[model samples]
Target: MRSGKQADFAYQAVYRYMIDLINEVSPDVRVKLPSLRHLAERLNVSISTVQYAYSLLEKEGRVYSVAKSGYYALPVSAPASYCTDADLLERLYAGTRRPGMQVLSADEPAQLLSLDASLLQLERELLRRHPLQLQPYSQPCGIWELRTALAARYTQSATRCWQADDVYVGADLRGVLEILIEVLGLKGAAVLVESPCDWLILRLLRDAGVRVIESPCDESGKLDLMQLEHLLRTESVHLALFSSTASLPPQERPHAARLLEQQGCWLLENDIHGELVFDPSTHFLRDLVNPGRLLVFSTFEKFIGPEAPYGYLLSRHLSAPLQRQFLLRAFRLSPIRQRAIARLYQNGRLDQHLRALRTLLKEQAILMDGYLQRYLGARLSYSMPQAGATFWLCSTQTVDMRRVFEHLLARQVVIAPGELFSVSGLYPQHLRLSHVFNGNHSLDRVMEALAEALKYGRIG
Candidate 1:
């Protein structure tokens, strides 16, 4: 009976009601939507209003129309995760295990950066007395015991109350990502990635057949959010993957996340260094977005220990049954190791370790940044190390990075070329210097080699 703009409003209200009804039904239901005439009669609205509502719901994939039959509700199901070439995965394991013979080439903390030996000894003694046993998989989402511990840690944060069902622990960042990709239907889906992103992510996207549109990063070293916004508007990217914290300048992150959400895109947050950020402004992205739309990947190795057995993934929307299936299919739980580790973290020891490490790293970053500026002069400045061990170098375009890398290698000094992280592999002039240099010896060796290399036109 409604007409004019009021009629449009009536149509929208009816459409939302129908969607709610469809969503409330069990996944087993076919949800044969009522015919337009029937719906109009039942709701006491015009056939045009019913038709418009149906059209809108169908467009959103909440329902579908058969050629001759009426529309039916679509199943609330996720997409399958598919990857190619286990060989690449085999290579990744091989590479990760070797731990870069050249000490500074890796991003992990200095071996000395761990908790003081005294604390480790104390932890070991405590574990020895407790001697735990492996138990049946606890809830498959993760061990509930660990979730309870984690929830307690974040209890004071701005986030809503977190439950055991909201957490999922996986083997590592990649494992967590794989599970998300599989359940989210990102395989063969379009994705927007930073040009010089984590190489492993690129590999994962490639294997999954996801088309990647690269965003150019600026010299201040943040991903260009404008480009990202443009792409999301024009392209069909369903996901945007980013390191929640990186050696580069803090991302124009909220804007990027907003753009993605506006375009109905999902965000995959690789918070590998999430716990390490000393700056308050560069908070974790998971803290910014709706948990249902964000999948956060975090590892404790950055703060506690690298070999820690468990990694935590936080997501709010994943159903319990899907999480259980993922746990059984992709990984087997090791309860004894997880519980033992959780005990150390729960007793305030982990907080102490993280605080101490943050202090040490912050001081080291200042020292390294100042040293790099003084020695390399105007053309070289350390990337904004908001927090984390990798010191990015914003080198002049004139520098010959290959020669500098080779010269440093000859001196037994190893650093990652900035190109290693680039999507197109086109950035040869930039470098990623490691702050994990063992005292003055390694730092001095790198400085001397770099000075000589610059003189010989080996690098600018």
Candidate 2:
């Protein structure tokens, strides 16, 4: 990378570090950010580079300057959206008038993310050494070497006591989830999911004969704890899967984890976005919760492409029966693929790519946020996520999003509609826009089409 790109990377690194620091404490407690010279020296970058980062953060309202001491982190004082679950649940699904409209499909494959050039190059080099050997069927969960690497990563800084024996691997995220559902006998179990949860997850639960209850979350993607506690107390929920994604591990995260544990509910940490956090040395929920009661599943596909075979399951309490069932049904990853991935861990390339990816994501967020503010600011409502490639949005007006989606589809603009995220199709106007803002898609064209769709979608 050239000096310009390096400077941009340095700026984002400092920006994300400040974000992590701000989120680490309660909003009420004031926290100061490192000085420009101090941060630049620590990061080994020029002081001017840090100055540019601090200025941009102030522009974005992420920090404030006192003119004397230095900058301080800004805490999230209020949620961006405040709609209640009951209110939104009362809204019907936004059915399209042109029910057969040939608009875009919400389900777009991970092209920029999936079929990336860098990841492909890395794979090609690894495959030359590891080759395409068919995996042996000895280790049902995974080979010991790969699992050991994952355990070491999970046990970063000696804060965690993860063991290779506690690790399990699967071909993909969906397959791993399927195994958990079957092994747990969740055919008719009651589960509590966050309102506006990922639509695909909701569909999977529905298919598994799971009775899911919803608790609405705010714009920051945090659910109402009182409602969650009530449901856990009354519903006897088998498991609770929700996102606690932030730049750094929020201190408040433990409260929710502890609540579920106190209720004797199994907690599944959806570490998809969690793993992609900008700060490389952030904490994880595993430190707060008992491992026996938690099952953490995450995919390596984010780092490598989607075809890069491996998703893992980590739990300290892997029973013999569950292990037996896993061996009987789970797909044993190819030996070569396991070795290649393990090599990624051993060489530290994985960590390098992660930092670069996080910086790139933050860069993408700023680009997308600028355009969204310029074009669809009034038409749509959203909060720039602290991490991840996707943006969760809700329409300002209650319109038929299904028709709006179709319109955007006709323009070759793919976006996830609100109905997919809710159990009752409550968020008729909510939608998720992904992958478009990362310089992969034409920003001007996508925004033009999106604005037009929302215009036609405005109905009482």
Candidate 3:
């Protein structure tokens, strides 16, 4: 009904209004926009004007239309300044790759390059016994056969003499921790956590409403016993969660354990990476503390493949309560997976796999450390881990870690910033690099990119 000039002016006005509305609302992706008629009425424009505006937005990839539904807003690509550390972490984990992108951010072990002949044989055996081994539902605690085998392995290793009853298998370490957090009534209680601890666990404690107190450790990752003692004496600390083997070197572990035991606070030891240690005798942490005061949990997902997602907790005191919580939570693990793992352990295949994995991890870690030294040298400082695959790295005083993180991210080499690990945005000059996921083939390229990024500061 209008002239072309009038229509164009009307559409432009409607477009400007829509842009202002989008800026005001900041809608999420797939969020429905106002209906065409509604938008036209609000803008005091013709329906054609609104349609024209929507068409322009769609062409610009700012909106999408669904059949029988109204237009929906596409996720706005905000400027990097608006992105938070958590957002950057999520992008890294989502594996957003650009051309020439080399990801160094993953914490998982590298995919097995080739099939192990022994593992293949085990797989064939598993397939042959598939139907016979299948069960309707897993036991509330877990498959008893797996628990018994794990108990025997623990006893043989001299870690602790755990009976099958004391070992309760769960979906994963996180799930086990959740159950423990609820059952132990950790809500609103003061919980002690190590500085630069596991970020995921720190988030878990916060979400559970626990007052998290950081117990700062020394350069060697050993808890300061005097400070910890002072905290224990002053504050009503409920529990202290830490990595016994991974964080504390062997010689320091017994003393640390003794200190923890004397404090009388409940201890939760994370041994998820204990099995991958190059030297088992010096890296073990089970025998130091009394089981009465400590509850230890470890995951097979790190050693065995992620496909076999199960973790076990050893605690005579809390096993019954954990089991009750598991029942209430309906946290049923897969019997088939449990049976497969138990078969691997029973036939010694698991031990062979572990030995091979440890060797591979050690090689990868050495390669990564060498690359770091070659690339960054004095600009970046780090202590090589004794047991785990991750290196805790810090930037020198001259280097800005935030700028370094931005540079590496731009280069498509994603590394976890140290800010993600702390409760109070501490350790801005730090990074955590895991060499386990990326193989040696990518290491050279990653180092080259890292060196370039560091040298150039921030690149387009």
Candidate 4:
């Protein structure tokens, strides 16, 4: 007796009920469903509602109907096997032997800037000025002074408008990303990541149960907008996580941002190496994307060396909710470290350190590139270092990357294989080398080992 509109709702409800009943029954076993009239009478709905519900189940393959007989349940599909590539990479990295190893694998900066007497003195003075900060736990969003300083710095440097409340501090970029993922409710959602991205982040997304769609990039590390647009048009991607400055140059970012925004996708820009820009007029995503749809992340660990533990996230859309969730989860960063970093920024010491670090890294990159080209010749190809300390190298089809990696590992020279960066295991003939971690003299040894590996297929 229900009306047409009410019958639609009744059918949907009955559809769910029938699905539950079908699931409870044994697979491949025929369960005779009640007739349309009988179901309508039992559920106190019209016969059309019952028929609509049964038709839905039939369409979904959850049940099938014979010409004259009743409907029967279908067997549910089994779950797919889990991929262990990330776990394998994790174990391989942990088992890496570091004793007397000329490590060219880490993305850490080459030289740590020596703190001058004035900077050391200032740190002591700040600690004395605020002894209470060292006594108890700090705020979950981190020390306000540091956040304010960071906001001011971003506004001044990038010409992006920001407030202190827009910043959230965390232990590191990974921890902050985890929190961001949770706050944005991205678990099990489709996320588009640039192919050959940071390996750790790829693993994180996989572990979070999200459907990861890898968008391929060009030789220069820039994302292919055409392919990205194709995916956006085809897939239900919720977020696009990518590096802010690496791979793609400044000019291309705005166009890419426009494409993403048009498709209503959120952008998570990881600007970890934004401070080491070789170009003076480089533009960041903050200047391109709508702040309401963007989340920018950066860390001192890349610029100030890996010893620096502090990192910050800036997002006008998610900051308030992120802070609430951060506090609710009882996450706290070290107050002392926060104050120390703030002091560096407050006194312009961080800028001074950055100038020196950039010069050193640029010099080292040139040296490493020269050595690589000189030693390996036509066997390997790599692009010049632009922003970050790492170089992405592609080997010729004749060379086997696995053999080269094993050869280097045997010589106590650990190098990151290109396969680790790809989810589909596409880059079997590529490698990633970090110039900042190894000195010029040690790099000479790396070249020697690589040349030997190329010639003899082993390093002994």
Q: Write the per-residue lDDT of candidate 4 for residues 344-443, one digit (tens) a residue.
A: 8988988888788778778878978888888886777777877767788887645666667667767767778888887888787778887776343466
Candidates in order have lDDT scores of 0.61, 0.65, 0.66, 0.68
Error of 2 at 20 (Å): 48
Of the two candidates 1 and 4, the one with more favorable TM-score, higher being better, is 4
| Candidate 1 structure quality by residue, lDDT tens digits, 112-189 | 377434444554564456545332344455566677776665443556556666678765555566667677777678
Tell me how candidate 1 scores on lDDT.
0.61
Provide TM-scores for the models: 0.69, 0.71, 0.75, 0.75
Judged by lDDT relative to the true structure, which candidate is superior, 1 or 3? Answer: 3
What tens-digit string does per-residue lDDT give for candidate 3 at 189-285?
9988878877667877877888999886666666676787788778888788787565565676787677767777888888777777777665455
- lDDT for residue 152 in candidate 3, whole number 0-100: 83
Candidate 3: segments with Cα more than 4 A from true spot: 1-88, 94-100, 110-124, 156-160, 398-400, 437-442, 455-460
Model 2: ten consecutive residues of lowest lDDT: 89-98
On lDDT, the leading prediction is 4
Model 4 scores a TM of: 0.75
Give residue 321's error in model 3 in angstroms.
2.6
Q: What TM-score quantifies how close candidate 2 is to the native fold?
A: 0.71
User: Clashing residue pairs in candidate 2, if any?
Assistant: 103-409, 103-410, 104-409
TM-score of 1: 0.69
